[model samples]
Target: MYSFLQVLWFVLIAVLWTGYLTLEGFGLGSGMLLRRVARTDKERGAISKAIGPHWDGNEVWLLTAGGATFAAFPEWYATMFSGMYLALALILIALIVRICAIEWRKMVNSTKWRNVWDWAHTVSSWLVPLLFGVAFANLVQGMAIEVVDPSNPMTGVGPENVDLSVHVHNLTGGFFSLLTPFTLLGGVMLTAIFLSHGSLFLAMKLTDEMRERATKMATNTSIVSTGLTAIWALWAQFAFGGSQPLAWIPLAIAAILLIVSTAMTLTGRVRSAFFASFLGIAAAVAFIFTVMAPNVMKSSIHPAYSLTLWDASSSYATLSIMTVVAIILVPIVLAYTVWAYYVFRARISVEDVTPSGLLPYKIRAGENFLTAN
Candidate 1:
């Protein structure tokens, strides 16, 4: 039962992660595509329409993941939240900027105001996932947290023990640090993969010239993203010593599908490409997660401070209660979320931004979005 629950919790975590990646992946991706699409007002409006109505709601998956982590893995929540506060703060700042771009868009009409929001949204959207990619790369690489009693305050132990009074052993990346060029480069690759994934989404949700433009963009984005992912996966395994020789097989499959999906999208298989890109990204993330399994954070400071699945899991009773609640509530949440998406699945158009639309009458439409296209 304990193992079963652990697996369930992991699955839930994966679902939550996938949800955020798919939803916010495109928000960031769509925003990243803005520079390319911004040649004209119609193109810009189409991008806006592509991402509108759903960006903020998409973020709730992150919130839900955090809440689940607290409930199911309190030890992890405490240790990482406390230890990684600095990185988390910057991540939070990016989140705030991303949210503000959506919220503040309605407050102005001038080109300057809209441009400011555009830049904010674009940059924040790009950085958010890059941060995750970096963090995930570091996580899979492992850490240096000590396995000693947590109650004992002073605990940064290394084999060649250097005891700095501070609990956090390192702030900046080290030469031997897991945040190596390969890892950071993987983050960059992830950013591109998500951008391509998002372009497919835009292809599905938009129409007329914009849809055609997105479909064209999706083809190129797929080519580039797949190429980069291929290069990164090879580098990660062979050169960087991340070889799970079999691991590359699934990623290879995902890469093939990415190419095929692009072909499909360009050939008027919009729905196929949309769904295929979803599969492609899911497969890719799964590949990464599989490679990174059993570690959420690694100690750059020293090997002893490393946090792993065994040390970081919550006590049995706590996990039990959380499991019970999740088993009961998660299905309901999934049901409702699916229903809501289906109900709102229609592609948002320029018309929806006008008065009398579902979101326009709301109290908090994005301020930049209020400006005419």
Candidate 2:
């Protein structure tokens, strides 16, 4: 049996991932829709401003989730990172580019510069979700993993003084092995859901023409996402969820919520639609964690080789220390996040977007740097 701390940390890690994806989903979706919903530069600026105050803050959850996984389950982290090195590198690079684009888009005066960064932002935003979906789908479906003795020279372990009784589960598949049809569908499903989520958020946070456009987009995307989610969730549950039959509860809840969100969007209930999508995403993530219980990493080579929660967890003393620290910090972080959102809760429009770029800031001969226009 897994220790109490092990189970607690597993649940906590799942919560962290759920928080990151649900919070960042709308921002990423908004970035992808940057060129789709906004026609003019000012309109695009308005959309950017809608998510600007919260996007960076939202990333903290992802960082925390990664850290938690590393500390709580070092072995699982090692295997996963080593296995998905190339894919993770691509994701990191895309995220860096997206961050740069968001921060520097208005720093230059040239329209060409802004346009290039805008496209970069959109592409990176789309890539992150796609890769994440693929990664998570692979986790649910199992991977090419095998247990190897450390004494085996061919397995990269030195024979000298090695413990033959202990074995490590390592991923053997190359990067291309991650691109099965189901995983690809998972990527597309995530993209569609985020698009709908972002459109709904924009509908609630924008005014006038932008609001109407966002509403229309949300309705269409939500319908598409709902359909895709139904297929994906059902496939995941039916094919790989025999071990955890009760996981169907959250899966069913997620599907029903998506349907309701679509209906709400169609009926002009923008705020309700956004909330439903948020809950739907959360439920879907819950379902994923539920299905993945008992085993942190499922090995396709053999059932006995799979890494269970106890096999992957940290020492009991380390978990105890981490638990204490988390109890003190998690609530504070959550409170601050809620307050920040509340402070920035205002609708925006094209008129609200002021002239951006360096050309808009000119200094007269007598004006100091601080007083410049």
Candidate 3:
């Protein structure tokens, strides 16, 4: 039973992370492409139109991840979130900007409004991954926390809730031993992953001249990402001692895929390259999780406040109920998500965003919907 809980715990983390990478991957990709679009408002509008239909739906993965964390690993949630409140708040705000930029950008007739959205979209899009990387980097690196011992020190809010012993300060407080080279490496790694993920998304969405540009960008980003991740892995394994030998195995597999995918993109096999990038990111994310598994959050303040999977999980009955409920509804959620993506598959069109000269009935005719084949 304990073992089962552990499995559920790990799987939940994997699913949430995977869902995040898959869903947001395209938005990042599209944003990068759109940022490179010709200066003309019309061209940028086409870029926006391409990504607008699916951006909001993609963010649902975050909600799913958060809900799962709340249910499956409530303790970790409380500690990390509460301690990291300010950073999380900034993230939520950035999410708002990214979503609003996507939604409101083309809804207006004025180029000025569209331009504003464009900046918001680009800045927020890039910042999301960087800030997220920082947060995760902080976690992997651990935080400073003050502990409350119940028996000896007899500290804590109450008997049932003694885990709230530690506190997380600002994103990077003035604590003497705050910064670590390893943590920065983690952040850089995350940035590389997201950038590469975004590149593949561009290749998948656009075609023709724009598509060719995307292909090139994807190739470049994947190559750099592969190299940087490899270097970082070596550093982590040897200098930082952050990752274990076993963890390097999946990471090695990911590296192989990363190289293959980069080569595919270089050869102009866009679809194949796209898949390879996806596979590589998946493997790397898994490798990082596996490497950082046992300690969700360690602390410089006190060892007692440090949290682990076993110490932070929900009860047996709760896990059982969650497992059953997730078994049923999770599939439906996934199906709806998949169906929506399939229904909207192919490249986005400029016509979709622009109101035609004709009435609504004629607009629904077969001519406007152009899928990127």
Candidate 4:
């Protein structure tokens, strides 16, 4: 029963992460793509409107994933968060900046202020996904963890006590310690994937000239992301000594979906392209977690210090209660989420966002300089 609950919580946690990557991945992508693909205020507004209704809601997945980890695997959460606090803190800051940028971008009609907000949105968008990529890579690659018994201070070794007794080495080296060649590869691969995903989403949500431009962007980025993903997956499989040999199955599926996604983009199948990108991200995330399962975080210094599923899991009673709660509430969350998306499924266009004279401050393109006069 204990082992089964451990596995179940791990799987649930994995699902949360996968869902975040698939949904919020495009949100981040769309934010960054706002600056890249949108040439005018109307164009930018179109991009913003495309994602605005759903971006905040999409972020809930990340929050839920973090919360689930804290509840289901307290030890793992403690060590991982303490060890990588700097990186995680930066990610938190980026998320805050992103939210601000999205909300404040349209409050004023000044191009200068809007530009400032757009850049903020774009930078945060890129950084958040890149950091997640690097963080997950480091999680899979391993960290400097040292477990010891506070009770047995002199020996610094123990038979076992599950209470929060582990040491996470964060202060000594800081964020740079998390970077490695493999982890760098993971960061870049994830960035590319998010960029591609965002472009595909724009292709799906923007009409006319914006749609064509977004489709082109998706086609170009997907080609590069597909290659990076392949290399990252192969590197992970090789680095781990092929213990989970079957990871190749999903990895292959991911590659195939990515290729199909790009093909659909070329053929002007916008919805199909977006769907493929979403599933491709899910499959890619699945491959990573599947390969790293049973072991939450490995130790860079020594193998014995690794945090396995068994050692890091919460008590059996806690798991049982959380499982019941999740089963009851997850479907309700999904139902509302689906309804929200369905309600806002219409495409966005420049005409849809033209500022009306209803507001006290008039909106005009390039109005910052004129307003000052």
Per-candidate clashes come to: 22, 0, 1, 0
In terms of lDDT, model 2 sits at 0.87
List where candidate 1 sits over 4 angstroms from the true fold: 40-43, 144-155, 158-178, 237-253, 266-268, 299-305, 349-352, 355-373
TM-score of each: 0.80, 0.93, 0.83, 0.90
Per-model lDDT? 0.68, 0.87, 0.68, 0.82
Residue 263 deviation, candidate 1, in Å? 3.7
Question: Relative to the unseen true structure, what is the C-alpha lDDT of residue 333 in candidate 4, on a scale of 0 to 100?
Answer: 76
Task: Quote the lDDT for 161 in model 1.
Answer: 51
Q: Please give the RMSD to the true structure for each candidate, in Å.
A: 5.7, 3.7, 7.1, 4.4
Clashes of 2: 0
Better of 1 and 2 by lDDT: 2
Q: Write the per-residue lDDT of candidate 4 for residues 1-373, one digit (tens) a residue.
A: 9999999989888888887899889999998798678999778878878888988778888899999999898878877888788889999999999999888878766677777888899999999988899988887787666566555533434324334445432222357888989888889999999999999988888889988888889988988988898888888888872778778888889989988987887787878988998999989887887788778887775666678888788889999999999999889878888999899999888999964322234545666634543
Residues 1-373, model 2: lDDT tens digits: 2399999999999999988989999999999999998988878888888888898889999999999999999988988999899999999998899888888888756677778888999999999999999998888888887777756624723334233248776788789888998889999999999999999999888899888898999988998999999999899999888999989999989988999999998898989989999999999999988888888888766777677888898889889999999999999999999999999899998888875576444457887756566
Stretches of candidate 3 above 4 Å error? 149-179, 239-243, 300-305, 349-373
How should the candidates be ordered by TM-score, best one leading? 2, 4, 3, 1
Which one wins on lDDT? 2
lDDT tens digits by residue: candidate 3, 1-31: 9767766766777777777776686676567
